[model samples]
Target: MTPSAMNMTKEQKEQQDIDDWLPITSSRKAKWWYSAFHNVTALVGAGVLSLPYAMSELGWGPGVAAMILSWVITLYTLWQMVEMHECVPGKRFDRYHELGQHAFGQKLGLWIVVPQQLIVEVGVCIVYMVTGGKSLKKFHDVVAPADAAPIRTSYFIVIFGSAHLLLSQLPNFNSITVVSLAAAVMSLSYSTIAWVASLEHRRHGGSSHVVDYSMTASTSAGRTFNFLSALGDVAFAYAGHNVVLEIQATIPSTPGKPSKKPMWLGVMVAYLVVAVCYLPVAFVGYYVFGNAVDDNILITLEKPRWLIAAANMFVVVHVIGSYQIYAMPVFDMLETFLVKKLRFHPGWPLRLIARSLYVVFTMIVGIAIPFFGGLLGFFGGFAFAPTTYFLPCIMWLIIMKPKKFGFSWCTNWICIIIGVLLSLLAPIGGLRSIIINAKTYKFFS
Candidate 1:
């Protein structure tokens, strides 16, 4: 230890050691675009793929409205997180759980924020497994001979799941930025391809004879349920809020300005890119396929072998990259718990075994519960509502302590109320849909 470090207390010395160890490299930190790419990559994966199906449920008018509303609310919550991080005294937090501990008490943060964030990350990996396997199978069927025996999606699930498990072994978040950048480009590429394909389909008379744009469902109860479910889908698409702090931590602080400014600029740029990618896919896919769209819009397109194949390839690659990005948090939390709480040293073999097991666990869950839409709704409502919507509002209210009955107070309360309703109603709607479709449901189908 250095002479100055030798004079420090044990706690300060340990903290200093941790701070020195946590950064992936000491040469240079990430640029603004690097942060943007990471954020955009996280925000624009399986969720964007589901937007057309969500739009089908809500129709054009309500669908567009929900998309816009989700964007605004998510952006506001993201900014709230950034603001909270900026307001902390001394050094900034590098993890979401730390920020939670700072805002709420340690107990609440441990019990609430950590687990919810884990769910968001692990849940997303599960979705990626299902999505990757299904997309791979679809692409295979397209090129395979007509007389070939069918291969179950389960096979592809294991294959891609193994691939993801290997990729999950990357040491830290910064190690995966190149993967994240490639995933971001793939996201944009597939989104653009899907959009152009949809437009082309419409030009080639693929548009539905009957295109319904109604805001309400056939029945009042059904309408309410469907609207909430659709809202859940929209919420899930915007669920990257949980990882904003981690992404921000990857970038070095700019000189002579609050770190929040660069963070905010990166976030805005990411959201703008996300909006560009999301709006066209949701709108164009709905326009072409109408209510007949599949949960993954790419599956609905059948023409131009090379183009569709390329898009599906992009989806698979993007998800592979995304699996690592999302899974890193879970790995970090578990490793931290083992080291800090359980008195285990962080070692390479232990890290590999722990992370590999987590990936396998998620893969098993994905294989078991193959109901893609239902899982999205269930987790989005139960976990993401709190993480993405409710908690941020609550944290801001607690930390900022806005005046009672003032604009900020009322707005936050409104968001909180909406989040509660979504949490309760969205699961009901999602589960109802799952039950209604249960007769035809099959594992690995």
Candidate 2:
């Protein structure tokens, strides 16, 4: 060992090892805008499409409150993640599992995050496959020959999955920044379209005259269950916390300088964009359609055929971009295990075959289930509540070990309690919703 290395403490040596493993290459490093693009693409996804439906369930006051609460809680956890990364003194825990190991002890860290991260991310890809296929089919129905046999959504799933497979081969996160930027723009594009369409529909008196603005649910049981489900939906909407560290890793840190500034800047800009995109769609769509808003607000729009079609097209594109951004972490994790643990050579052949097989696997699941709302509820409640809410608070408490009964201590404990409640109740509500809707469920329906 080198002289300085030989003299290092155990913690210092361990930190050095991690730093060596995660060297930020010039090509892989990015600027703040690139980070912002990645965060926006990761955060604002197909979940945003459900905001209006969530509003329908919770009404204006409660729905907006839920959305804002989710946003603040998620943003706070994101900051916690950044703080935890700096906890090891000189070492950087650039991956989620690393942070887990640091806070929860060695093997427990990987066990804690790997399965849930896979569920949230792989689940998202499956949702993307289903949503993309449905959007494509809708677009086709609009423009295709009326006499032609209606194409099944599975065909479009394969077509889009193939495209995703191609994009997945782009090697690393920095390489996909352009695609993510396009996705951010597409998110804005489709959201703007939905908002404007809702306004016009309201002005022109297109649908039912009455708009329900009451905070009461349809039934008392519904108020409890539906509100829980709405909270889960809002949680799902902000589920990008799980991947924030991975996104932060792409931005190069200057020597001896705090990286949190650029990281916070990117996060702030991205969340600002998220708030702008989410509020209008939720409010306007709910105002226009009230309790009748469809799970995907775009589906509720009937007139302005071209504009709605354009918006759906944007959804497909944005999800395509989103699928890759989210899946890249899963791909990295799998490939790392294969190469480091199994001794597989780090080469293009392995990457292409492994990633392609993974895509096919998600696509198959998408075809078999093809139930969008159920999967959202399941993943949102079962996976996201813990990953996005529970774990971050726990990690901070563990790492920081703040003074007992202090503000940080109380706040973290409160968050932990909230997260636990969400984990237990949200999934029950989500599963119930899935079961109630199961009788009508069909493959690709």
Candidate 3:
């Protein structure tokens, strides 16, 4: 007898075929909690890195409010996932690029997706490179205490970042899922610890200055501008949900294509989990440091000696995970265009050239923008605004078949309106600060 006929019951043979057809590590194969955790981890990743800096403009109230707004947006995106499953069921669209094409049609889809993908890829890489440099610098300060040049900080970042980016090209969900979970643990552990430790600073009675909301109230323009600019930070914090949709096609099906309810549930739990983790940190960091919190909280805290090295490693680990997550889609896109479509084989020569170029690119950008806080703010505010806020609502209205207008629609429209306002706000706020006050907007500073 053939292997399939001899060893298996009819039901067993059928089930094996179904499992074989399903992609390995697809979203369907992921435990519901795993998907939830994957998304929640990414959501918190951006916010935690950003909260220390956000304290400046919004203070505790507004900064915390801003992150809360991120959660609200998360809720909206979760609702979109429900609608997405309803509209684009089964394997109708395997990637976000395909979703964009289906929603907006080919011409308009390319316009939106190409730039969005590029921005996400480049922004993620830049963040990793910069974060790596900072962590290395921290490490050098601890180990050597005083070194003339400290191993040419930029050189160290280029070397390490290049190696990691190359590793990222070999796509595997199991590896990434593990990393995502690990990132979540580190992010939550440190953020929670940091939040608790911050209480110590507050109990010691740090200086306090209540922001005068009325100061900007005289002209609604400035206050309007401040709130709008703050929205970018909020959008950036909430921007990772779209990533889930890209990975949704990977799940295994028992009988037929799986129901989207599990996926939607995972997305929802992830958002709520992230909200729980981030809100407290934003609240405490603002409350503890007040208006003086550094853009990257790692810079502000003076932790125990033992924890210092761990803290440096924590940042490094976070960036490593982030780089892998962000780079996957970019590599996927390149593969689609080059190997899949163009029929260019994936050869050793091609891999060698790509690795060399990636290294050079990482170094140049890393050295130029040594600071990432402002760069993230700008991208979160401007580049990602359309995708996070504007694109989904527009897609829902124009593409998805409508049954009844629901609360989901209501929330997404609010996101759309907020996103538009922020896109305008980022440039206006940046320019106003510059032209009026002669202050320059710094990318990393």
Candidate 4:
């Protein structure tokens, strides 16, 4: 052992060992493209399938504007987080809460960021659990015989969660780089398939084929709620900021050359890929199916059997990786608490039990309340808006202290204002939709 290691107290040595073994801090060998792959996996996920349904609620003008505005705003917010990762030389904010602690104060920052970050990350895994289930059911139905017996979505959800029982044990983010890369590719692929299939549906149209652009809701209250809910959906689509700092932490930071340069480069490329995946599926899918579009565009498209079936399988695989991407951070938090606060021994047994229980918990909840669209709207607005849209902006303004009324000041305020509005208004619609669905929904079916 080194002289310093020999001199270290038992507690300090144990803490250092934990730091070396923990997932986020364990690796610093990631490349810029790792950022691209992880960002793409996190960004272009289950939210894309719902964009068409969100558009149907929003109609053309607002839908197009919301999509464009969110793209630009989120890209800016992501840049802010990247820059702040190593803002203090010789120190790094390796997790969202760490950055929050720096900005808000130790206790207050953890309070401000942890709950919101947890909601975003844990909420996503729950939603993706539902998504994976739905996607698997869709794939099976497409390939099975016309007379084949139907399967409960709950069963598929359990099956999907089962994958995580194995995968959740993976050590950290860098460990899943290959899976994340494949998911990035799959997200782009399935998104392309959704739009291409949608376009083909339009081109082979009959003279009588109708594509109505009118709002589908019959009541004024319903229309208002749907519009608010659509805003949440758009907000949900740009949800990579919660993990930007963690992803950047994987890339080594040095005094002379900060990690932000390479991280920023990766995100620029990642955002372009996001636009390419998001826009066409949303616009074209809604344009083709109009008010009749299913919340999942893949559910709306039934033709070209082999292709659609393949797309659904891709969704299952993509979410499998996306689930892990979000889950690793949560795992970090859980393990840290257990080891540091609860004083549990830091070893494989603690990790296995903690992670497995978490997987089961989300699985049961997903099966019990599998309202995909409503959950997206609710969680999207409530948690996602703050973290993805405005939390980082708020931190930037606070820490950087840009001049009052200047361009930076004005822009950050604009994003915060919009984010606050979305957070306040959108959940009303989402909760209402859930309640209405629940009146008839039988749990665990």
Estimate every model's Cα lDDT from 0 to 1: 0.80, 0.81, 0.62, 0.92
Location of the lowest summed lDDT over 10 successive residues in candidate 1: 19-28
In model 2, the Cα lDDT at residue 79 comes to: 83
Name the candidate, 1 or 3, with the larger TM-score value: 1
Give me the overall lDDT of model 2: 0.81
Write the residue-wise lDDT of candidate 3 on 367-436 in tens digits.
6665455555566766667777677677776676444557656656777887787776764553443344
What's the TM-score of every candidate structure? 0.92, 0.91, 0.80, 0.98
Would you list the clashing residue pairs of candidate 4?
A: none
Candidate 1 Cα misplacement greater than 4 A, ranges: 1-28, 212-223
Question: For residues 1-445, what per-residue lDDT tens digits would candidate 1 score against the true structure?
Answer: 9876676777686655544443232112667777787788888877888898889888767789888878888888889988877566666766788878878888987777888898888889998898888889888988888898999888888988999767877777677889988998999999999989989988877654666555445788887776667777877888888777777776676446656777788888889989999999999888877777877888898878779988998999899888887887777677766766786755677777888899899888888777777777777787888888778899889889999999989988988888888787777777776676677878655
Error of 3 at 357 (Å): 3.3
- The best-first sequence of candidates by TM-score reads 4, 1, 2, 3
- Judged by lDDT relative to the true structure, which candidate is superior, 2 or 4? 4
Ranking 2 against 3 by lDDT, winner: 2
Of the candidates numbered 1 and 4, which has the greater lDDT value? 4
Best model number under TM-score: 4
For TM-score, candidate 1 versus 2, the one ahead is 1
Q: For residues 316-386, could you state the per-residue lDDT of candidate 4 as single tens digits?
A: 99999999999999999999999889989888899899999999999999999999888989999999999
